[model samples]
Target: MIRRFITRQLRQPLPPARPESDPYARALPKGDLSGGRPAVVRVDGATKQALETGRTRLLVAAVSFTLAFTLIGWRLVDLGLMADQHEPSLARSLSSDALETGRADIVDRNGIVLATTMPTASLYANTQHIRNPQRAAERLAEALPDLSPAHLRAKLASGRSFVWLQRNLTPRQQDRVNRLGIPGLYFQREQRRFYPHGALLPHVVGFTDVDNQGLAGIEQSFDDVLRASAKPLQLSIDLRVQHVLAQELAGAMTEFRAIGAAGVVMDARSGEVLAMVSLPTYDPEKPAAAPADARFNRASLGIYEMGSVFKLFTTAMALDEGIVDLNDGYDVRQPIRVARFTIRDYHPKNRWLSIPEILMYSSNIGTVHMAMDAGTPRQKEFLGRLGLLQPAGVELSEVGQPLVPSPWREINTMTISYGHGLAVSPLQLTSAVAAMINGGTEARATLLKQDPAGAGKGRRVVAAATSEKMRRLMRLVVVKGTGRKANTAGYVVGGKTGTADKPSGGGYARNSRIASFVGAFPMDDPRYVVFAMVDEPKPTKETFGYATGGWVAAPIAGRLIERIGPLLGVAPRGDDNELIEQMLVDIETNAEGRQLASN
Candidate 1:
C-alpha cells in the first residue's frame, strides 16, 4: 500500500514546469520527465538561499578538521623519531640552569670536588585521585620497601589533595614506582647536596640539612654565598697535606689511646691554613647518624691550657721589650710561691740557667720570674697583640673564645706566663707562633685561598731581631732540649713542647692531659707551621708510661715534617750547626766567661 501511495504522489508531482525565460527555471538542469519519474518542481527564493548557505558551512568545517588532524600527526612522528637527540639536549639545558635554583659546589684549592649538588626524584601523591586507598598503599609499599604500608594507607585515605610519599628516590626505585601504574602517584625533580670525600672533611667542609641549609663549619659560615652564587667556593686546604696531617694525627691518637685529636698545617708566610683536622669525625652526608662528640671541631672550637707553648710568647715578649737578652741568666733552682700557687719546673736544673737554657729545659720558675719583671700589664698587652686574648678570626663559625682572668692580677700573670690560668684554642696558639717565627709580622689566619701578590703587609707584633732570637731559641730547644724528638735530620726543625693537665673539678685533672707539639722546618727560613695535639692521651709502654708532648706529640710532628717537606718543596740542606753556632756566638761566649769566672 505504501509503494502504491508513493507511485500516486509521483504521478501527481507534475504540477507545472517553468518556462526557460524564468530566472528560477534557468537555475535547474534540463531533463526529460517520463516512466513515472517526478517532474521538476519550483520553490521560493528564500528556501533555495537557505539550502546554499548550509552547504558552504559544511564544506568549511570539513577543511578545518582535516588541517587540525594533519598537524597533530606530524607532531607525533617528530616526537617519536627524534626523542633520543632531543632528550639529552633538554637535560643539558636543565642541568646548566640548575645552579640558579640550587646550591653552588664547594671545592679544595686544587679544584677537587668536596661538596656538590645532583638531581633526584621525590615521590608525591594527589590522594584525592587514588581509588581503593588500601590497595594503592600496598602496591606503593612493594615498589618502595623503605616506606611503611600503614603510613601510605593513612596518607592516601586522609582525603587531602596532596601528600609526600618519599624524598630523594634512586633511579631503580623510581622505575619500580612507575611500573606499578598507580593513578595518583607522581614524581618531583629535586636537588641534593653530596660530599665526595665523605668523612675526610666533615669538620672543615661541614654538612647541610634536608632542605640544603648549612648547619656547621664552612657550610654554615658561607651559606648565603653558596646559595646566591654559581661559582664553586674554593678553600685554602691542600688535599694532599690534609691527608698527611690527618693520617699522622690519627695514628698518634690511636697509638696513645687518646680520647680525641686535633691538627693543623699552615703556611707561616701567608697565614693560609693548608689543613685542619679534628677527630673523631663524622660523614657529612649522614651527620644525623653521628654522635655529637664526633661532630665537634676541636682544632678551632675547643679551648685548653696549652702548657709550655705559652712560654714562646713570654720569652718573645721579654726580648721584644728589651727586658731580657739571649745571654740573660736566671736562678731556676727554687720554686716560685705566688699567693696560694707554686710554679715549678717539670724537669728541674738546680742551678742558674741562661735565657736559652731556661726555654730548653721549659723552666716554669724562670718563666714566672720573666713575667714578674715584665709586669702584668705588659704581659696582657703583649698577648692581646698576638691575637690570643680574643677569639680566632678564621673562616669558621665554630671558633672558641680564650678564657682570660678578669682581675688580671700578678698571680694570673705568673700562671699565664707558664700556660695556665688562661685557656686558648689550638688555632690561636698556632697562628701566634706563626707570627713569632714569620719575621714578627702578625698574619691573620684565614681559610680562603689568597693571592700572594695581594697579601697585606701584616702588623708587626715584635721586632725582626726579636723574631730571629726566638727562632734561635726554638732551634736550641730542638737541638739540645725537650724538642729533641721533633728534630728531623737535615730539616733544622725548631719547635716547642706542650703538656697541659685538663682542668676538672675546680682544679687540674691528674690523669687527663693534652700533649701537643708545634714546629716549623728549616728554621733559618721558616715556611710552614705544623701543630698536632692529642686530648686526654694515656700512658703507653712505648712512651715510657708517660704521655708528655716530647714523648707522644713531638714524634708525630717530626714524622709529619719529613713526609710533607718534599711535597711542600722545602729543600733539605746539610746540617747548619756551624752557622747556628756563629749566630749564637754571643750567648756561648757569655756562658764561657761566666764559667771561667766561677771556676
Candidate 2:
C-alpha cells in the first residue's frame, strides 16, 4: 500500500513552490478568482537540505561574533582596570599622585599668580551606545557651535566607544550640554594651564602648552622643580615692578615709534632681577596666536653691538690693571684709521681728554687709543675676566650667545674698544654693570628669589678704587655728556648713552640705528642698574627729529627709574652734587660756560 501511495504521489505533478523574492517566503499564494481552490506545495528533500545548511552557517557566524565581542571586552577590562600596576591611574590619570602630572603654581615674589594649572572636563562619546546618531549629534552641535552637525553625526555614528567631542570646554558649555541629556556622552578630567596675568610677565614667567607642558622661558627651565614640589615657585620678579616696567616700556615704544624695545632692572648689590621686559610681547594665555617676532625675548636673548656701553668695561680694565690712570690723557683729536675701518667720535673734542672725560664724552677715538695702549693680549684677558665676550650666566631659556671674534685680531681689539665688532646680550651688559658697581664683585644672575645662602656669592672682578672711579665717570655721562637726559631729579642716576647704527650685510645700515641707555641709581651708594633700549626708533617731532639715545632711550630709563623706585622701596636720595666736582671735569660745562660769559 505504501509503494502504491508513493507511485501515485510521484505520478501526480507536484505544485511548484513560490520564490523567496515574494513578501512572505514561506507563505502560500492566493488562488485565482475563477473558482480554483487555494493551493500549497511542500519542499523537496534537496531544497530542504540547502535551507538547513544555510541556517546552520548563520548560527555559527552569530556565535563567533558573540565570542569575539566577549573576548574583546574581557581584554579591555583587564588592561584598563589594572590600576595597581599603573600607580598614577589608580582612580584616574588626572590624579595629583602621578609624577610630572600636576605642577605647582608659579608665583611672583609676593605670591601672585603668574601661572597655574586647573582641572577641566573634556567631553567624549561612545558611538556603540548611540541609538539615534542624528538626533544626538544635532543636540550636541547646538550646545557646541564650533562643531558642525554633519561632522558630529559622523562622530556619533562611528563604531568607536571613546571619541573626543571637545576638550576643556567652558563651564557654561558643560552645564548646557549636561542639560541636553545626551545618552552616550561622557566626561574626562584634564589639566589646563592658565596665565591669569596674560602678557604682563610673558618672558619672565613664560607660557605652557595646551597639555600643560612647559614650552618656553622660566616654565621650561624649572619644569622639573615645579612638577616635583607643591610649594609655589617663587621668582625674583615682582608683578608690580613688572607691570610698571611693561607699562613704561610699551608707552615709550609708542612714543618713539620703535620697532622693538627691551629693558631690565637689576639689584646692583645682589643681582636680583626686579623687572625685565621685552616688547612687543604676546599674551602667554594665548601664545599660539602671537606672531614669531612677538615671542622673541629681546632683553636677554638679542645680541647687538651696544655702542658705548662697552667703554665702561674698557675703562675699568685699563684702570684695574694700572695700564692707565684717572689723570692719564688720550689725544682724540684725529679719527683712528686701521686697515679699512676708522674709529671716530660723533661729537669730537679735537684734543686730549682725560680718562674720565673720555667716557663722559663717549669718545670712540679716545677709547680705541686707550685700548691700543692696554694692548690686545691684555684687552682679551681683561674682557674674558669681565664676562663680556661669552654666554650670559643668567637663568633664562633664551640667553644669547655673544658674537665674539674667535681669533680676536687687533682689529677686533680696536672695534671692541668702541663697542663694535663683538656683540653681547643686554643681560651680559647688566651683569658687567653690577660687577663694576658692587665693589667689583661678579655676581651671576638668577631667577629664583635669592636666599641668604646661594651659589651666586660672587668673586671680585675689579679693584674697589676702579669701581669708584667708574661710578664717577658713569655719573659724569648723565650729568654733562650724551646721557644728560637720563639724569632723574634726586635719583643720582649714572649711565652712558649708546647710539649704534645696526649692522646690515657686512656694514652698518646708513639710517637705521639702535638707541640705548644703561644706568645705575644712587651712584654714591650704588643699588640698582637699569638698561633701556629701542631698536630702529624713527625721528619724531617731539624728539626734535633726533633718533639718538639721548632723545629716545635715555629718557625711557629715567622714566622707568621714576616709576619703579617707589615700587621697589628704593627711597630717592638727595643728588650727590659734592662728588660732581671731581666726577665731571673739562666737561664743556666749565670751558663752554666760561666761553659764553667771556663772549
Candidate 3:
C-alpha cells in the first residue's frame, strides 16, 4: 500500500484529455510526432506542485539515510579505534559507571607478587527488562549453586532498573549463565583483588572488599596511594626471609604450645623490615571467616612489658651519657627497694656487678642502678631519642602505642629500666636495639623499599663508643651469658633475652609470660636485627622445664640467623678472635668464656 501511495504521489495526474476542445491539445494533434520532434505540452499548476512535493520527499529520504549511516560509522570508529583501550569497561558502561583506575599491584622488593588484581565477570541485571522472572531465576540458580533462586526471583520481579545478581563469577559459571540466554542478565567485567601468596603475606599486603577497597595492613594505610597510582607498591619485605621467619616462628609456637608467636628481621643499617611474621594469621582471601584473634598482628600491634630487653636501652644510655663504663660497677647485692616494689633479677649475682656483667647476667637490679646513675631525666630523654617512649612509626595501620607510666616517679624509672612499667611493641624494641648496635645511628623501621643512595643517614641516637660497648656486651651475653643457646657457630651472634610476665587481671600472671630474644649478627659490624617472641609459652622438655626467653626464644633467633645469613650472602667468619678481642672489655672471664672462645 505504501509503495502504491508513493507511486501515485510521484505520478502527476494525467492531464485531462485536452484533445477535443483545447487549443494546445489541438496543436499537439493527439500526441503525433513529426520531423523527429516530440509534441510539447505545458504542465498544469497542480501537477507541477505534486511533482515538486515528490522531489522534496525523495531528497529528504536520501539525506536521512546518509545521516543515519554516518552516525553508525562514527560510532564504530569511536569504539574500535578512538576509545580508551586501557579502560576495559569505558564504552560498555559509560552512562552507568564512572571512570576508575585498577587497583595497583603490591609486590615485594624483589618483584614478587604479594597482592594483585584479577579480571572476573560479575553478573548484574536490569530488573525492568527481565522477562519470566521465575524462570530466569531458576536457570541462574542452576548455574550458580551458591545463589538462591528465590532471592534471585524476588530481585528480578522487583520493579527496579538495576540490581546485582552475583559478583565475581567463575568463567564456567559465567558461561553457564550466558547459555541461559536470559534477558537483562549481563556480565560486568571487573577486577578482583587477589592475594597470590594467600595467608603468607596477608597482614602486610592486606585484603580488599568487593569494591576493591583496602581494609587492613599496608593496604589500608596506603589505600589512597594504591588507588591513585598505577605502579606497583614495592615493599621492603623479602619473601624468602618471610618464609624462614614464619616457619621458625610457627615451630616455636607449636613446640612451646604458646597462644601465638611473632617475629621480625630488620636490616640494622637501613631499618628495612626484611621479614615480619605474626602467627595465627588469617588468609586475606577469606578474612571474614577468620577469627578476630587470628587477625591480631602481634609483631607490631601487641604491646607488652618487654622484660630485660630494655636493659639494652638502659645500658646504652648510661654509657652514652658517660654515667657508666664497662668497668663501672653497680651494687646489686640486695634487691633495690623502691616504695612498695623491689627490683630483683631472675638470676641475681648478689654482688657488685660491672656493666658487662650486668648485661651478661641480665640482672634487673643492676639495670635499675645503671638507670639511677644515668638519672631519671636522662633515662627518659635517652629512651625518647631511641624511639621507645612512643609508638613505632612503622608503615602499618595496626601499629600499637607504647604504654609509659604517667607522673613517671623514681619507682617507675626503676621498673622501666628493667622493662616493667614501660610497654613497647616488638617493632619499637627491635628498631631501638638496631640503632644501639648499628653504630648508634637511629633506626626507623619501614615497610616500603628504600633507595640505596637515599637511605639517608640516621641521626646519631647514641655515641659510637657506647654502641660499640653495647655490641661487646651483647656478644658476651651470647658467648658466656644467658643467651648461650643462641651461640650459632661462625655467626658471632650478639643478643639479649627477655622473659616478661604477661600482665593479667590486675597485676601479672605468674605462669604466663612473653618470652622473647633480640639479636644481631656479625657483632663487630652489626647487620640484621632478628627478634622472636612467643606469647604465653609453656615449659617444654626440650627447654628443660624453663620457659624463659633464653630457653624459648633465643634458639629461634639462632636458627633463623644461621639459615638467613648464608641466604643473605653473609659468609661465616669462623672464630674471628682478633675482631672479638678488639671489642672485648677488661672483665674477669670464667672457664666457660675461655672454652667458648677456644671453640
The residue pairs in collision within model 2 are: none
Pairs that collide, model 1? none
> Which one wins by TM-score: 1 or 2?
1
Model 2 Cα lDDT, one tens digit per residue, 359-439: 888899888888988999999888888787788877777999989887878898888887888888887888789888778
**lDDT score, residue 240, model 1?**
87
TM-score of 1: 0.82
lDDT value, candidate 1, whole model: 0.87
**Model 1 ranges with Cα > 4 A deviation:** 1-96, 129-153, 179-182, 582-599
Poorest 10 consecutive residues of model 1 by lDDT? 26-35
Best candidate, TM-score-wise? Answer: 1
* Candidate 1 residue lDDT tens string, 297-319: 99999998999989999999999
Better of 2 and 3 by lDDT: 3
lDDT (Cα, 0-100) at 374 in candidate 1? 98
Using lDDT as the yardstick, the better of models 1 and 2 is 1
Worst 10 residues of 3 by lDDT: 90-99
> Where does candidate 3 stray beyond 4 Å?
1-99, 127-142, 148-150, 156-159, 179-184, 577-585, 589-599
* 405: Cα error in model 2, Å: 0.9
